[model samples]
Target: MVPQRKLLKVFKKTTYLTTFLLLCIAWSRLRLFFLNVKSQPNAVEYNGGLIDDIKLMKCYRWYKNCETLYAQSAVHDNSFVLWNRVSKNMTDSSLYAIESNWLYETFFYVHLFNTNANKEDEKQPLADIAVSRDPSLVPLTVLQEVMPSLRSSDSMMGNKRLYYQKTSWWYRFWNNPLPTKMNLMNKWKHNNDILWSKIQHDSCLITNIQLYLGSNFVESRPFWKEIIHELHNEDGNSIPISITRKVECGFDANHTFPKNTINNKDLLQLKQKSDLKILQLSDIHIKGNEENSAILGEFQSRIFISRIIDIERPDLVVITGDILDGNKSVDYQTCILNVVQPIIRAQIPFVISFGAKDFSKYATQQEITDFVNQIPYCLNKNSDSNGHLTIPYNFSTIPNDSKDDYSNLITQNDLAIFIFNSKTSKRQFFKDYISLYKSPPKLALAFQYLPIPTYRLSGVFPIIGQYNERNLLPEGFDNDDNLINYMHEMNIKALSCGFDHSNDCCLQSIHDIWLCYSGATGLTAPHSIFMPPSVRLFKVDNIDKSITSWKRNYNKIDEVYDYQYIYNQPKQKHTPSN
Candidate 1:
């Protein structure tokens, strides 16, 4: 036999070559398929010129052929529909989606011939296309009669056709095409008055436009009554639906308390329900300054708490990190003592995790113990800080424990809260156990808003550093492979942290992991509340102790502040008419 090692080497080389040859053959086939599909008639042509009706009819015929070929060959069926139906004289609702994505390409060719190219050649075909559907040839009165259903359909509620048509706002759709490419291809379409106005006035043909525009952020009201009426007409089973609305229940405008006193004894009566009511007050960057003071002065004082207690009546509250101004000052603990401690005193259970500023210096067991002692409901303890505490902290520490008769609340219960200390640059130890457990009624992984480094924005600290006495990031901090590996090990669905000052948005994930930045609830000017200073409220429901319901309220405080900013007044003009 020829040596066995040499034989093995020959086999490995043959396998590599065979794989490379197969890849080349596949790539060649894909290129040939692409060419064959594009070679269809009018598939390559812009057809910008406007010939007489005789020639224009031919162009439309050719356009139809292209549409047929595109529909059959394109992998994305929607793309074919969008391009063909918006090509003029093709107004069939079923033929097009609410948003015709090809408006730009179609309009580009139409306009290119009209404005920049040879007039007789370009304008003839363009005019021919326009004239084919004109009242002069087809007659406006006749077209209306021909499409009578399209006119009266808007008034009908829940009509499938009407709903689909109204669902999209045509005016918005028309304006959305980018204006960057204003060359010959887009010139003629830009001046098409009849086509554009038809899009706006034929609103009835668009079903969901009313609903889309009638939303709180938009103009007009296609009220619930109308929606209900539509639902009844559409199907026997269609009934009015009501979803529980969550309001970020907090006070920011410094509303004066009533002279009548509300006792804490009476306040404790609200938490007696089995339903879990958790309030998230996140992204509060408290830098001790005038702006921060203004925020606290308006809502952080005793008046604020009194108002909140009277209004929201929450059972438990979670401060999802960021309780300091800057990482520079240790004064954050004092700020919390002043603001958060009083809220805790009112007998409302609240949980807090460290923000970016809190972990400038690592916490010791004593520091964690002292902080928790001051804020009794806080999950961290002296033992927890030392890494000696058991996996789940004692739920007995939760004040007003209703299920006190039952033992093993932490070990056996479905409502376990995990508060990961995200203040440090490196991953926390809690990450290790997250994957091992099942989803709970509430699984919260709290970290500071150390952004996943972007092209423009730098993260909280220098990147690519090893853990050292001065800088404490774990090994391979800057490596993408390491960061993702750490997150996977932690079994995080979605992480909630508070480092950013802009709007809270979500990330790439299956879980509703929201990257929430609640703005400065304290004195920090480096932050802006994107719109307003606010908190979020989640009404978490459990089915067999698994978290089933999570609803959020956005821009609650901002809505109040925005109204004041616009009207220069505190309240709106309307009260209930009755």
Candidate 2:
């Protein structure tokens, strides 16, 4: 009886141990499965042509067989209509089989031969295959009409046609493609006319091909490569199909600067001069769309900016904020490219201080920073820099006088240009800037999107220029005095902001710092008054130890207003405008 009882106790202990181990294993496996699902990318990596080639061959064979059948049929009806009728009668046996007229048309476009279709010696087809996964249909007939002109101008390949496919949930879950690439490819087709105008001067072609199951952003992928084509599934979703050719091009494929590097001839010229001219273009709310009005407005804005750059010929350009109407823009990337084209063409060193609208459903702040930094002559600092810029200057001629030393003070570089993002942690960024250098440059100027509390106060403080609207402070900065104190402590002479479109004023704060506003430069943004679009210009003279600023209205007469000296000024009673 004692042996039997002991045996029962041992069995019970073994069963309990086994149960506990099994529970732990099950929990761990479940956790791992969830983690894997969470970590999986929206799109799969590009598989170089193994499966893609086989699929392409199958599609080609189906297309040839269909063409033969259509030619044999004596029906004189529209090819598109007849193809539909025939497809309805045919049995769907394979994945590549043309089961609908849309598929037949897609296949026809994809296999479209050049003018030398009958020439047997011409082995390689003139047109390459483009597959789109987007639900929106490409205007194949319109594109066909435009293709010859594009080919004649060398803007596109001879007669490329896009194929379509329907996407499946299982395929998307396992093999989705990068969204950025897909978006770009879709943009190329949808905004072909706009894209052609933008890239007509550059030679572009497809150098590499990739196949993806679904579309999603390349969060972990680097931005060095550019998308040349997109693959589409039957449901109208799209994936990145090809990479930009490795030739000299004007767009994203080729960038002059590496990450966080600043190389601009105009910036380098600052070392040799005592005076620097800076152009502040604010609120050029460009909405990249297909509308004629939108296109014309964007074009006019570019011309206006170009004319201003040519007229002012400033040493640097500072776009205050709201470069694009992010909410309204069809393509944020295209809008960004359009916004910066003038500055890039002028070869002027520029920095951007993004606004509230800059961060929208279309793009994040980091993505904008990354995209802008890639453009040539752009001095936009990396995310880590907290939007700080110091123009490099020669230190050999440091002024000996303590008073002049402040003016001539050069830390890592010569003049300090601090650009703050209103949406970011302003106080923290200020703290970080202060911590970086023991003392600030005497004539340092700051740029941001939203105005501080000091700008809104009336009475006692001397104000210049037009204050047509109320001031809007950045979030959590209404009662915060640390930023103003930091600017004062750093001896930052002036701070320029651009959120209030109607308020274009320079007010002397109690801290002796100049708080200025750059009026709206965009034609599309709202305006309380019947004033023309305008940009503020700042000229900093090291020899005179002064900074002069004024607004130039975009009109036939080039009207100028609110001219004021920022430094060494006397207190005045009333606001002035010209």
Candidate 3:
């Protein structure tokens, strides 16, 4: 019989082919690993193209506060693309994505590398160190941006792959398909494509290519390298430069200024002519776990908030607190950064009020306040233990016919948004009176702190609908009989607070004064898939001195009973103190 070695050598081609294929697989995986590990150096650029889009967004934005309607470019600006950069760079959203993706891909890569490339497992989370990004302001940016597929539907399951078993029946039956589910999805995708036709009207927005394989466990890395290169370049336009619109909310532009207006043009101009869309995301109780492994809650919240910002493009965002779910000391920085960074990047002024769970986990109330003040766009600038946040809209005060900056004196609509630290989340005071009478239950959750009367909720929801039962404000603020009295004096029309994840809104006073209990923006973990999360929105009819609010429970919009709260100048609800 022929020697065993000689028998193996007889099939040299097969052996060489098998070896070649194994190397290819390892190489392909290595490339994928590198892709996710590195911050695409060119991601999230704020280039002139984007600045121009910002101009278009200003012009084509649903709320046309300015008279530049016709001037709204023959082309509509893409707000989605501009906002994408703001989200990716402003927060760790993209970085976390890259790191996570890299770790996943590297797992496979290193395994293959160990077997094929003669490398050993160092037990490293990733193969390489993370790259840094520029956070400073600059013009003409070139970025590698990450975005939810502009092509995706409003479906919560998220983006679908291109080639799937579910092909359109119209194509299968050889007929032109329009108005089909596939067709509608396609058109919705075209929405983003439509934005770029104006910007790059000269070139093809996308190109398609077919791929091939070499072995069952191996693939050609060269083809992948070319694809990745194209992907990196293709992303340049298909990403930060793309646009998508998926809003179910209504937009009202027909304006009838209040019947009696101040004669001052500057002041009248300050009255917002356009409908104000204020997006409220409350009770996103992100746990303060410092570990990178348990950040899905934070990620989900960031992604949802950012996506909603893109879709809603609201004039203001109100984040009713309870943003952190972990102990106040547990990686509060990460929770705070992930929570508020998007608003900061969008340059939208926002307000935050504390909730029962906000300080329940780890950080103290003061620590949370310090974190909030660090964000520039956070208008809650009170350093005391008092209970109020006053945020000014950074509106452009450019006069109708003059070009002068009145930055200091005026804000959008010359209106103010007030946030109250309604004492829903207690300051670790009175303990719960459970089965034990002053037994000091071993696992005590809430109890009133001596002299403060701040009721805390350790592991239970705060009892709502009980007025004045708990401390509604810090002790310092009790000097005022009722906070509404102060709101009346300040001409504050919108006051928002959160503690209850319930969607509760009411016209608590006359003349369009709104007292809103913004429902939880994100649900507590280990919840059922069907437990709908709630968020609040206010569409302000500035001329009417009134606002209409809607409660968004999951994807459904539930209008409150007294949703429309409009002010009539003649009918004063309550008298202000002298």
* Best candidate, lDDT: 2
TM-score (C-alpha, index-matched) for candidate 1: 0.35
Local accuracy of candidate 1 as per-residue lDDT tens digits, 1-578: 56888899999999999989877745543553353345366443222122111111101222334332222111111222112211212222211122223321122122221223353342222221211122113223223433455444332222233212221253245332311211122322212221211111111111111111101111111111121111111122321111110111121222111221223223322343444555556655543222445444424432443344445556766565556544433333334543564455555755566554543232343453364543344434422452221123222333364435332333333333444444333343444344333322233233333443321223343221111111233332232324444444444333444455444433333222333333334433244434334444443343222222222223342232211000011334687786
- For each candidate, the alpha-carbon lDDT, in order, equals 0.33, 0.53, 0.37
RMSD in angstroms, candidate 1? 28.6
**Model 2 misplaced regions, further than 4 Å:** 1-271, 383-385, 388-414, 426-436, 471-479, 568-578
Tens digits of lDDT, candidate 2, 296-386: 7777877788788888888878888888786675445555656666776666777888876674354455666776775666767443455
* Local distance difference test, candidate 1: 0.33
Please, what are the lDDT tens digits per residue for candidate 3 over residues 385-470?
45543332323343554234333334222344444455432222112211212322111000011112122223433222322223
lDDT of 2 at 348: 72
Q: Identify the runs in model 3 with alpha carbons over 4 angstroms from their true place.
A: 1-273, 288-297, 326-329, 341-345, 359-370, 381-389, 392-414, 420-480, 507-513, 525-531, 555-562, 566-578
Minimal lDDT window, size 10, model 2: 49-58
Measured on C-alpha atoms, candidate 3 has an lDDT of 0.37
TM-score of each: 0.35, 0.56, 0.39
Runs in model 1 lying further than 4 Å from the true structure: 1-273, 287-310, 327-333, 359-369, 386-412, 423-493, 508-519, 523-525, 543-578
Better of 2 and 3 by lDDT: 2
